[model samples]
Target: MSDKKDPSVWQGFKAFLMRGNVVDLAVAVVVGAAFTNIVNAVVKGMISPVIGAIGTKNLDHYDSCLSATCQGDQGIQIMWGSVLGATLQFLITAAVVYFLMVLPMAKFLARQEARKKAREGTEAAVELTELEVLKEIRDELVARRRSEYGER
Candidate 1:
């Protein structure tokens, strides 16, 4: 067969782009980037000082001399204190999100889903009992038989 591009490929791509999940993912990416700045600010503004009070706030200060001529100005430097501060900030932000946002949202969504399922179950139960459906089928067959025989 001769090679020919399918027009439906573009249509499918367009449909995929328009889907709700893709749109939601795009929004989440933007929002998450914005939220990261806020978290970083909170860490720098609020958490760093409290850590400073503990006198271990700057983890990057720990250094070991690597050379015989290790004068204070010529020695190798390690920046572990800054790293420690960043790690602590990450942990704090994660804890806040877990407790303040994720946990409550998860619980609320679970309850909402449960209530929806219960409503659907109630509606399904009210719609038809097995005996009622069987009766309906039996009546249909009886009417069909009577019609075939031209009975009253």
Candidate 2:
């Protein structure tokens, strides 16, 4: 009975895509993807070399074969070294992101929030002072009016 037409599905989809959180999540995904390479490079270049100095050059090579012979996964073989390498890589990535990005961002946000609260407090004080001044002026005007009228 209404003249208005219902919105199209594509319009709704477009609205969802254009939302702030969706855009932020997309940006985060892209930045995370780009940052992954840097973490990987650090692990491969710096951490790997340090580990290599103490042990084998390649961490992947430090595995144990459950079977008598490890012929290309033909027998049961536990690749604990690969697991260790992966774990190390994850730890390095987490540490780099935590120290470089997360910690700094958290500190910055806290400082910003503190500044915002301080500003709000000052604004409230100023507003209260202005209200008090206005009330005093109103009281003075009323008193002068009453005195002049009482004389008549």
- For model 2, residues 36-140, the per-residue Cα lDDT tens digits are 898888888988899899998578888888888889858887888889989988888799889999999999999999999999999999999999999999999
C-alpha lDDT (0 to 100) for residue 122 of candidate 2: 100
Question: How well does candidate 2 match the true structure in TM-score terms?
Answer: 0.77
Kindly list the per-residue Cα lDDT of model 1 for residues 51-92, writing each as its tens digit.
778764454654556667667688665656776777876897
For model 2, the superposed segments whose C-alpha errors exceed 4 Å read 1-7, 65-75, 138-152
Per-model root-mean-square deviation over C-alphas: 6.2, 4.0
In model 1, the runs with Cα more than 4 Å from the true position are 1-16, 56-59, 62-76, 127-152
The lDDT for every candidate, in the order shown, is: 0.79, 0.89
Top TM-score model: 2
lDDT of 1 at 26: 96
Tell me the deviation in Å of residue 147 in model 2.
5.0
